[model samples]
Target: MASVVWYVCLAGLLVAVSGQIVDDCVLVGGEKKSDVDVAILAKLAPLKNKRFEAKVEEGSDTYVYTFVVCGRVITNNTSTNEGLLQTKVNSKDSSVIGRINETHVISGSDWILLSYRGGDKYDSHCGSEPRTAMIMISCTKNTLADGFMVIKEERSKSTECFYLFEMDSSVACPPEESHLSAGSILLIVFAVLVALYLIGGFVYQRFVVGAKGMEQFPNITFWQEFGNLVADGCDFVCRSRPRSADTAYRGVGDDQLAEEPEERDDHLLPM
Candidate 1:
């Protein structure tokens, strides 16, 4: 029991002596990290104490919030000064994710917003070892078609490099990328084309195939033959009486033609 007390006292002394800035803090959870940095959260003297800039309204009354950690909430007060924060690098929690309002393409560093988890749970658990770190694998907010989303970027050490991922209320990526591709559109077009081809073939078969196997096309000879056939059929049907004279004459001529034969030239006999 005496040893436990000493250990607790020693921990308190170490925390007090370290008296560091936001960069020195350890990450607990909720935010991702990366070796490849997306932006410089601070160009100079980063992760240190500062008065809450009006541009970075971190949900505090006035310029009261302490400091900005890369992927975690602002620790309200960890320094000797009222609005000052201590630096820490081993973060356990992440910054808050806020909405991006612009429609234009946004890229490179210099992002728009900052956010993180706050409260007792974060303060107690953050900045510890074995907590490990995560990368910002993606922040797909800029890619969304709806033109609205909230996201944040953070850094973590793994594989000797940083990675990037996302955390947010909404809109980093659409539910599916299949809608963004041409596959669905191509399939619809192909189906419509096939239907048209089948319909055209059916229409051609029905309209072009007459009582004859293949209907004769509308050329000069075809029209003339068609006219003759129609006239002959009409005359035959309207005949007032049987004309045996013409019929008998035509039959006798046809029989004579059939009976007539050409004289044979016997080349073998002549030789």
Candidate 2:
């Protein structure tokens, strides 16, 4: 039983760790420029007949970029309330340059208002223009399509990076979302369940089993009571016996208590 419980606990731990590793890998790979644009963008809502633009500038130690994304969330028979999203990233090293509000409701009539400004540190050895980078956007509505969005400089441009202006009409708004990741919540719940199970098992073994075993045999309290009863009976027997130690050790003889003969009567006549 103990071994089984241990194995279960170990399995749960492994599962939890694996889930954590996967989540971390996703985030890290997403941050890397090598990540697939479609994979990253799959998380956002789709856009239709919309265009995106990137403007870049070099500061003292960093490269700054501003993104303006405009798109409408598409809804069909199966979905509703598509949201428009726009986000910006710095090119030196792909980090969130900035994000607009997470959920922008896009009705058939509303155009997405998306703009963000963010920057990354510049590498001194790299050329004046930052390397090519990608942005991914996703939406919950299935009607929304996912694709790659890229930022790069024109071939001949030295001081200016690439500009982007493309319209997508097939995308829809992302579904209503929550802050907590599903995997994280599952891990927490599993941990709590395992903890409770262990605690309950421990308590049952300690109190219930011991109590049942004691019920079938003499307890310390019963033995103590029996001891006191025997002690009282022995005291009564001792009190009833003769008090003298000599009498107790050796029995009294009646012949030793008889009087001895007198010798003084014959001498009184001569005086």
Candidate 3:
């Protein structure tokens, strides 16, 4: 049982190492290009689980190539040859053409190149070097009708005995930079300031001043006074204007004066 567990752990470790795309596909710009890599990976995540196959003819040989991006290709293996990118079927019936890149060497710039070394050897047409597979990633804003296509199944005069695969996908596009507008920045700053003011005030009142209940509010009195002042100002501006004094009160009539009563009082005093 312990040995079985150990074997299982080893298998899992091998799977992880073989499936690691980041280690196999290094970014062109290193650390600074990490964001671009992340963005591209996120967009390509849909393709992570999907594998593509295409049939192409090179010279007299016709081959069906199978591959995936940032992932491994799993299929029925008729031969002992093993690789993520391989020829599933070929007219020559050689099991596999050759493992173009078996070591999974990292290469490419804006475009990503995944190459691995170590596999079966190619015929004299190419060389005695071990076969390898190379998958190149290219980005497109357009839709992905097909995932990957065979670029060259066999070695060219200038190139070595390796299989080349290329893919065009929207996932390779750079992410659009999003920035906050001036108004948004100002609004956020204002909200943060208000929150800080209230929180600071509450903490100070609750602990420093030993306040309880509603009194724990910071500058509670000042805020209340400010609210009242604001209400008063609004009322003063919106309420109806007062009537003029001339329209509010009427003048007294001269005929109603009390001068005769003073004269009668003086005469009574003299008598």
Candidate 4:
């Protein structure tokens, strides 16, 4: 399985490198036609909502800059500033392509490549630098990698590209919110536990408790025990009630005689 994944990723990276736009691409109206790549970018227009991260070095220090798609602001931690920010984002589409020494802009059927200067730092002035830097993003159907990005020289060779990890199928990218939040997940788990308890109790009463193996406890039925409890409670509540002299009591329960007083004796009996 691991080998299969590795090969798929390799193929995807190769595809990304091969699709580098030697020209620029743009959108005029709604139609799209690229010079060299697939429709990957067009399909993932939603990428604008996602954030991507990569490490860049400035002098002797390395900082992680997270790029916000379709937005100009780059930050070390995805904010406008810890102390600095990136300028406006420059966006182009598959409809137009440009090729020049200062910048190489190309649009292909599936990919777009831009080689410009000064997207190198998270500082505000970094956007104004006049040095060449290129970024190429291309999508793939490979199970191992949803896409790959080129951050080095324009039309970067296969060795210079980085394949991205697989994407979430339900979401276009990793969501800012967890797929499953801790609180809601815990509530679902608790509900499942309660359901299981009720089911187990029912099964025990209907089958396990009354199976042939339970003959040893035949006198312990639920209703019988419950009736005995109710009778005991009633006796306790009525313990102080007056009793007639004619009634015999034993073990705190009245025991009526089978024989009744004779007709003559009944007439002389006092209430």
Best by lDDT: 3
lDDT ranking of the models: 3, 4, 2, 1
lDDT for every model? Answer: 0.32, 0.38, 0.57, 0.38
Please give the range of 10 consecutive residues that has the lowest summed lDDT in model 1: 98-107
Per-residue lDDT tens digits for candidate 4, residues 5-56, read 4334543554365333211222222234332222333323334335545444
Q: Residues 111-205, candidate 2: write the lDDT tens digits.
A: 22232212222244234433222233433344343343434434354443323322233333422457779899999999999788766755665
Residue-level lDDT of model 3, residues 1-271, one tens digit each, is: 6534443454344435443444433343343333333333443445554667777765876667665454444445642324444453533453343332233333233455556456466555565666666777776667552567777756665437677777876644544556989999999999999999999988899889999999998878988999999999988899777444355556677876646754345656745
Off by over 4 Å in 2: 1-115, 124-142, 151-271
CA RMSD of each candidate after superposition: 23.7, 19.1, 12.4, 19.1
Q: Model 1: per-residue lDDT, tens digit, 61-131?
A: 22212222332233446321112122223444332221111001112322322322222122232342112
TM-score of each: 0.18, 0.18, 0.46, 0.25
Q: In each prediction, how many residue pairs overlap at the backbone (N, C-alpha, C within less than 3 A)? A: 51, 24, 14, 19
The count of residue-pair clashes in candidate 4 stands at 19
Highest TM-score among the candidates is held by which one?
3
TM-score ranking from best candidate downward: 3, 4, 2, 1
